[model samples]
Target chain A: MMCENQPGALIKMDLGSLTQTAHDPIHLLPCEIQYDGHAAVDKYFTPTICQGVSAKEVSFRGRPLKGQEIKIPAGYIGLVVEENHRPCSEEEGRTVCMKSTFLSFTQWNLETLPSADDCAMMSLMWPKISEAIHRPVDSEE
Target chain B: MELEKFERNNWGSCRLSSLVPPLCRNQHCCLGIDEAGRGPVLGPMVYGICFCPLSNKQDLEELKVADSKTLSEAERERLFEKLDSLKEYLGWALQILSPNVISTSMQQRVKYNLNALSHDTAIALIQYALDSGVQLREVFVDTVGPAEKYQEKLKQRFPELEITVKPKADSLFPIVSAASICAKVARDRAVKSWKFLEDLGDVNLDYGSGYPNDPKTKEWLARNLDPVFGYPQFVRFSWSTAQTIVDSRAVPVRWDDCDGDEKSSSKGSQSMLSFFARKKDDTKHQPHRFFQERKLETVKDL
Candidate 1:
């Protein structure tokens, strides 16, 4: 959503929260993420999944997999799909890249998922920590 | 309140707040008004009014308030702070007369304007104090011109409150002196801020000391002598010396043929030369006449 003093009328969503919910195997086959605004269409797969695969080894819809690297950890599926078929210009200038590595994968079980109370407590405590980090220092004598 | 004790000494003491009859009785707040830089050859004339409650009469008396000239600058500054901090009120009004105004207005007329301005400023301050919840009954001013004239002016402006005017009131009354200090300090600050001599090179003048005999002041005048520079905006150009300086710097071609006019115009230029001339003329006639008369009397006796 938009708020006063925000530079542009765009909403920023965190990919980390979506990745945690998608890690469960019994969660659902493919969940649809519906939002108000546009999204990217390119599907991205983690580098670990494409490690030993060569170009033309995997193909989908008569097109060979490009074996492109994904910056996120393995088993985390992330992609941007636009609701409209509008073309967008590529982002220009300097950019910072982030990398995440998965050490191991635990068995996904829906019964072992966090309770609603635990999830609520984590959400509430996370903001308090973030607020404490962003608060200004009092310099008055 | 009593003048008996102070009569024996040249410098007297009195309660400043109690001088005004209404204030002494604690009926209402009293405001004393006075001005500075009226007779100065330079600087703007500043008028100031100070108000205080009758209860603090003793505190004001303890400070020994006197005319600004009588007190040292440090002492004036100290009392200034104390008066400012005390339960009192103060207001200031300033009028900067250019050399042109001074050159045009008669001396008496200038005094009238200054007195009228001071009375107006006092009334304004009194009204301000009243509006701020102060109950004021009277205002006292050290008269700059005739007491009757200032009294008339004050009455016209503030018909509701009582007004008192007296000669040398700053010396006779303590409150007037406090007002004098306030006016003087304010006027001095104004003069300091002015850029009268900014365009004139090399000559440094400080408020002209408000005195005519200052040498540095005379030098400043001599240096800034052009139609464009004119008389300094702060100076009282009505004074004869201002005109004389301006005339002295006039183009030589204009009065070059008239030596007599030049000499007369240069009158009062050298204080020492005039003094010696007067001394020589006095001794030449009186001493010789007495000696000749004595010699004739002796010859007649023989």
Candidate 2:
């Protein structure tokens, strides 16, 4: 399926020096939250992590979440983007700014560990695979 | 009745106490320990200790505080109130363990069982009373597990005090009967005033005794189960009754340690060779160990 915005929103991401500095680690949670606006994640979701038998255990809202920190592959950079405001009209293309960067993020599972079956961990492998697949092939071969 | 502690964080256990009887503190006192709601799949388990001057044992008997299990809810309430009226001669303390705490502790990686939790709560209540200057010379406890072992454990903890543990101590000892009443009444109140942290609308308070075998409780557990979240914090998630409902009704959650070793045990040195031989034709497209472990694949479209 293809989705096209007629006057597509243009996200002008500035991966400039200001945004290159590392920020706090990110976390990918299993559950979906209804609201999408800014949240006081630092204040409310301060995770007290303990090492479990096979994973890192954390309690979020009285529920157990287990996972581990996954680092970005070498020679790769992760950028965090944020929009200043919604565009007034469709004609006014959206501009999202790069807020910060991160080298690693914690991937959480609901009462489980981040495993090969998790889509987030699976998706992270793209850069390494892409780099190998797109490499120059010898004409002699 | 003094529930100000719950106001801070409702999910954790809290202690409540009656005034330390001024006269009882100076005299040789007998303390009794008992617990309520241990069989329930819902609500908190309360450990109560009731103590009074050894001379006031007759007063407790006169008040007709029998085994709480033998009394109706109404009779228990009346007797509890009567006991409260004689607060000048008696004192009581309760350690209320929240369902959340019970569930979390039992389900920990190290696995703290219910019996250990109960023993600890009972011990804590006794220590708290002693620390508060109760002249406790003897303690009577309704046994959990083997009577001898529990008695031995308590004797080790408080060698000075005479500790007696028996299965039906509540029926034989008036002070223990009084402690049972305190535990039962406090458990009832805790269940009655429980507020759901989840946004469950108009929850039915009548969960019917909360015992696993109660039909009304079984139905309540079935009806109240949320497909994704399982049950509210009121339910003991570690209870097999709650776990069965979750297994059948809730979404599947796979923990890493559960089956990790079992899957790898069948494989040996030839596993890598077998894998290479099986997918030789598609080796170029095959994902690396990192991707395979997380079950990831390259996207063909956005």
Candidate 3:
């Protein structure tokens, strides 16, 4: 795909196929609702309108995102964390999902996601699958 | 707990214990014990045992057991596999002591020295085989340590079985040689597939034989010396070679010998005015052989 700067205010872009198979089934789209320069973010997911478009050669405007948010989110944090070490709003202060985090999936969530009682009887046998990859070499101490 | 269903706990760490297969009844049974990786600076030192009915002596002899050092690795492995398949007639066991355990046992902090550790492991394997109901009348061991003391220890453990803890017994006894091959094969596989948990970055790890004299092992140690953490755990840190490399690479930590005891006694308070005053205990001595009062004997132009 190629990105070309066109005359006036339009940018011409080409989208092509990315891979042979194993395409991502999920895509997130951004929507903006504005009052002057202030924009209200509506917590809503959009249904796919263009189903057959190949998601290759997407033109990124301005700078690409620094993918920090994926690793550590900026959402609600636990109270157990120390104040100095806890993830804080150092940049723009409205607490957005701790950049990439914020989703509630705690040890407490284990009670709901797949509770111990809800798991199959074979759940305890998981270790049989996790054999040691490398046994230590002999040491003549 | 999720761990309750598992038959054993240490499916994860190195196996330094015995695993004796059940022996078939009938045919006078005897056993041979030998070790591999004893002097190597890498991998677990393995003690292997081949116990079979007296009838299978010819079968073990047919395997053409010799000092594992003489056999090629592929040859040793082939023989090991054949011995493994004959479990119905022959029962074998191994005590795989991981490098960590070996290092731990030999390190400065632990005083259970290598000979004792090796002896204990060998004895444990024999005991395990005996407990597994294998009728073992005689046992032959290939040992580097003093055989008399080793034989005594084994005899004390199993008073009925005839025990011969002879150096180079692997050369004399075909069964012991077979055990030696088993040990050597296990050691080879272990060293070949040793995994480092840490991301070693670009360090090449094709160390040859894991022996101290191997230049490749030395090179790998030199290449992988982490400035702060030293070598990876696969290295026997207690081995002098590894210890020397790690110590040389490390920041020399010369800790002063601690002389103070735990007691903290308070001294009696002294008068603050004592600081300015001369002590009564001060004694003065006359200067001997001094050129006092500026008196000088001048010798002119002699």
Best by TM-score: 2
- Winner on TM-score between 1 and 2 is 2
DockQ of each: 0.00, 0.10, 0.01
Here, model 3's chain A TM-score works out at: 0.14
For candidate 3, write residues A63-140 as lDDT tens digits.
011110111123322111111132243221121111121222211111012233322212322333223324455697
Model 3 Cα lDDT, one tens digit per residue, B1-302: 01121112111223332334444445568889998888888776778888887777888787787989898988887887787777677767767776655664554222668888888888888887767778889899987578898888889989999888888899888889978887788777766766544445455878777889999888877886654445555677778888888666743322112112222222235558877898775685433332222222232211
**Candidate number with the higher DockQ (2 or 3):** 2
Off by over 4 Å in 2: A1-141, B264-302
- Candidate 3 stretches with Cα past 4 Å from truth are A1-141, B1-23, B253-302
State TM-scores per candidate: 0.45, 0.68, 0.55
Restricted to chain B, the TM-score per model reads 0.62, 0.88, 0.77
Model 1, residue A21: C-alpha shift (Å): 82
Residue B39 in model 1: lDDT: 72
In model 2, what is the error at residue B90, expressed in angstroms? 0.4
* TM-scores (chain A) of the candidates: 0.23, 0.80, 0.14
Q: What's the CA error at residue B289 for candidate 1, in Å?
A: 73
* Model 1 lDDT tens row, B245-269: 7545633222112356678877848
